[model samples]
Target chain A: MTKKNSEAWKKKYEESGLRDADFSSISGRLLEPLYTWEDLAGSDPETRLGWPGDYPYTRGVHPSMYRGKLWTMRQFAGMGTPDQTNERYRFLLDKGQTGLSVAFDNPTLYGLDSDHPLAAGEVGKTGVAVDTLADMERLFAGIPLDRVSTSMTINAPAAWIFAMFLANAENHGIPFARLQGTLQNDILKEYIAQKEWIFPPEPHLRLITDLMVFCRDHVPQWNTISISGYHIREAGSTAAQELAFTLADGFCYVEHALKAGMDIDEFAPRLSFFFNSHLDFFEEIAKLRAARRIWARHMKKRYKAKSPRSWLCRFHVQTAGCSLTAQQPEINVVRTALEALAGVLGGCQSLHTNSMDEALALPSEKAVEIALRTQQINAFESGVATVIDPLGGSYYVERLTRDLEEEAERYFKRIDALGGVVRAIEQGFFQREITRAAYEYQMGLSRRKKILVGVNEFVNTGRRLEIPVLEIDESIERDQIRRLAEIKERRDNQAVRGRLEALRKAAAGSENLIPPLLEAARVHAALGEISEALVKVFGEYREQPFY
Target chain B: MAEQRIKVIIAKPGLDGHDRGAKVVARALVEAGMEVVYLGLQQTPESIVRAAVEEDADVVGISILSGAHMTHFRRIKELMDGQGLGDRLLTGGGIIPTKDQAKLKEIGVEKVFGPGDDLQEIIDYIRHWRAAQAR
Candidate 1:
């Protein structure tokens, strides 16, 4: 045998008495004693890890990130009727929440009002129901339009929901450019995990692009879309799968925008991301850093985005809802804190921490406050923000970051081979991956390979533990229906019909639907009208039923 | 007969998109060796009942976290009574308190399961109830 081959084999044998080929999770991953020049041999770590507020911002997007402005602590809060939900909104703001993330009721989500036949018994249950401008006004009663940035978590009828917010803000006399925040306007991930989509992909992508163009030209400060990975993770995926699939989805959207005769720089800068803070500590942190670096390189080299903002990957994070356990519910607070820290260390611009009582129901006021406070404690007490990418130079972290990026890039090739993400989704690639990952997680727990503190391992008291679960006021249904009845009675039915007619015409044309929906919203046209108008142009998307 | 398998249609009858619990219960029911059909998120009472009638399922199980469980369950029960399904066992599970559980039963729901409920126990209850219906 050659002398060089003999020496390599001898070294590996001495280390573990086995070949170095028998590792899975962290192998092609470089583990270092300390990340030095030797660790970054083939890669220019500095050019890749550029300064905050510079081109290819792998460090962060802003120069004085938290030192200038602490990350926006936007808690995901909603439930019941608009009035009740509005009260919660005011409460959250009073407690120092900088932004608003509204969760819509099931009826509102499905484009039905409280009194709709299909909406029976379901209104104001999952989230606040807003049938018309009246409920939207009640939802933002005391809150000023020009001040707090609002993020609406709607997908199927996102354009309508966004139009409602815009109409409300305009009525409040706030101009368009003054608005800030995001709409989960991401319809692609709907096909992946959430399953709340209204129209099919072609029309849905058109709707998403419509918002992007409208927001780019009009609502400059507003984020048009937040390409989401949080739902993908919550639906059951490993940290790596979540990272890969989410970035893949983002890439697909970028490509779609480019194909639509739109410049990448025009829409790409305003595009943001949403990720989940799962329980895996360092792994989650590495995933975020890798996301930024990979996105930066891809945007600059592939898409030719000249602006640094276009390259910088900024995201909002919510703690993993699936991580919370129904058993020993109080432990969720500790879990949320750890995941929030992961988000911060990973450099999220805005974050929503899940409540301890979330496994039970929509968070009660106190439960939500605890959730917001988890972020507060992490920001103030933890001192994690004192240093930029505090875990950036760590040997294990860098190694894992490279390893995950490589794993994700492999998925990117498979996606490209399948034509693109939309085709891949149609072929059930993502669905299958998430299904397999979910099974693996459950199997791990079943075999005790993974540990859920209070669930599989810890012996808990069989007795019931009491905590306050939020109850939607029973009057909400009657109240919402009454409001809708009042709207139906009060509003100009003919004008609403004409505006909706305009919307239908616009939907058929290659025109943006937001402006027309906003016009419809001005006349207090119900969400149903706006959604059905779009539905007229774009038929509903049906999934291959899993169950 | 080994056992006349109790077939149940488990559904989330509102916009509550959270389905982890519903899915786990569906899996558990299948493991407990019963015929179960799960209608995913955003199902309405009318839609669920239609599915129940179409499937000819004996029991209807609902999982709601959207806090509209009280009103939602009431509508389901009312629909069933209207359709002559008053004999079919209707059950629920979610973040319901004890007070609401009593209220739910008053509205004619057979049982309410909250977090930490034993899937095996629910499976046995279904079997026992179905056998009693036969007798």
Candidate 2:
């Protein structure tokens, strides 16, 4: 864009009534009504974007991209017992799901057995409950672990759950090398946003590093840690915060691995990211582009990673669950489609379109099918995926991408000044920032500055939602506890005791915890038992006072 | 006689980590001059009821978005009764269906606020309830 052309465009924009209207992105970033060559006056294509598959991959990490193969349509579906979720998984796969994303129930996520008092009423409520290798076997019943890529949204006890998964695969005679999946072993994000941390940050990071090293050696195809901004965004972070904080956490993990004497190139390639695709269309696309570019540059320049594969920032995206409104719930389908489109446009390797009933309850099978079909339509009918980086060079998009990058860099500096992400987390820096953003956003809605269609405006009353809300029977808790009790009765208690003893010793020392975890899982030690063993050594984390 | 400031305990009594609604409602209560004791994420019903009794709360609002509202609310109700804090108003809001909300109210929940309900309504309800208690 030339100076003269930019000046002419600005003059035209000023003259136009449309340009005079108030404008801002969803994150409150100012948006120009008209963008021109002047917006990119400083942007050099090669330096800024490079090519789709090249260094500093602003466009995408893959050259052919979606043209060669469509993004993996992974619908995150899990609720009730393992048998029920197993059925849901098969249904989704039968309905053209390219991959599986498991949503563990609160009990499983908290590393508690279904029989625990704290786990009462929560077993398999939010997601599938897996208390032991037996539940894992049932959860993946008849589904081949080697054939499909699975992403489990679990933290805190991710190593223990993953141990169960490996044991399940071995029982099924599937080689560990053949297993392909991602573990949401992102404890940093747990402390920062989700509030699901078990141990303090240091020990949690040790567990993560252990998983990374173990996966690097055995399950080479597995993504050991999915550095997640999805939960951060869901926790009310702005787009820039999500980008900056998630990348910072990724860098923290990289630094941890390096400190543990692991070669960056050996493990970095397996590092994956999960981001939220919110309502902001262009901003999300720009955020994804900026994310890839920042990651590639940092890996090459800052970390000095030797492998070109290490420079690729492969990511999965799920449509924002927070955006699904309870009022006029059917319209959430449209919102999800748009968000999914943005994710696809932004070059996600895998995507999950949130179901319409998400705001009300767990997605019904019909809702899940629609969510899956939304991705299929985008891939087959929309023709948007026919080319790589389809919206790469647009003046508006490029300007937005550059702006997002700059904002994220500013945040990176802020995080660094606060003494890196971990210290920032300890100081409640991330929580405060996210809380303020959430409060402001809520205030915006109340003040009518932001119209949420059916929520703030276009008001509908006396409307009954006829859509089926999936009811999780309370009997699930009883069933789960009974099963857990049976497992405890049947498993070799002596072997379990020995493994837990060894686990306690390892936890006391600085040992890679995966081997002990695997041994315990093999002995059919319950998730809570193994987690309790570690908690004995590494005391549990209680959040520093943050309102 | 000087009026006591209304004490409230905002509780998350389930596994669901979605606390946006709870935090928003807590902010409203705080703005309304109520002292709030926030029981953070993944709290059990017994813990919530214990907090309510310990905080000497006028209201015990248990926010649960997960579908286990029936179990949690019922459990909390039982604990509240056992703890002899039945006078403390039990109220909450989430993705709960109107039918379930009715059932919950029938089972002794004071009021059930659904999604997008006016925060002022919550404040007004709590204040009104507190006044009735005093009377």
Best by lDDT: 2
lDDT per residue for candidate 1 within B1-135, as digits (tens), equals: 587777889998766665656776777677778888988777888899999889888989998776778778888899988888889999979867666888987888868876545566677888888889989
Task: Kindly list the per-residue Cα lDDT of model 1 for residues A63-90, writing each as its tens digit.
Answer: 8777878899998777777778888888
Question: What TM-score, over all chains together, does every model reach?
Answer: 0.89, 0.96
Each model's DockQ? 0.36, 0.54
Q: Write the per-residue lDDT of candidate 2 for residues B1-135, one digit (tens) a residue.
A: 866889988878766777777887788788879999888887788788878887788888878877778888998899888898877888998888767877987889858876656677788999899889889
Residue A51 of model 1, lDDT score: 80
What does candidate 2's lDDT look like per residue over A1-547, in tens digits?
4678767877986786562223787888888777776678877998999988898899898888987788999999899999999999999989989899999998888898888877777888889999999999999999978999999999999999999999999999999999999999999999888878789999999999999999989999999999999999998889999998999999999999999999999999999999999999999999999999999989999999989999999999999998988888899999999999999999999999999988888889999888889999999999999988989899999998888888889998999999998899989899889887887777777767777878878878788566888888878888989998998999999999999999999999988889999999998999999999999999988875345
**Model 2 misplacement above 4 A:** A1-22, B1-5, B82-84, B128-135
- List model 2's recovered fraction of native interface contacts, to 2 decimals: 0.44
Query: Judged by lDDT against the true structure, how good is candidate 1?
Result: 0.80
lDDT of every model, 2 decimals = 0.80, 0.89
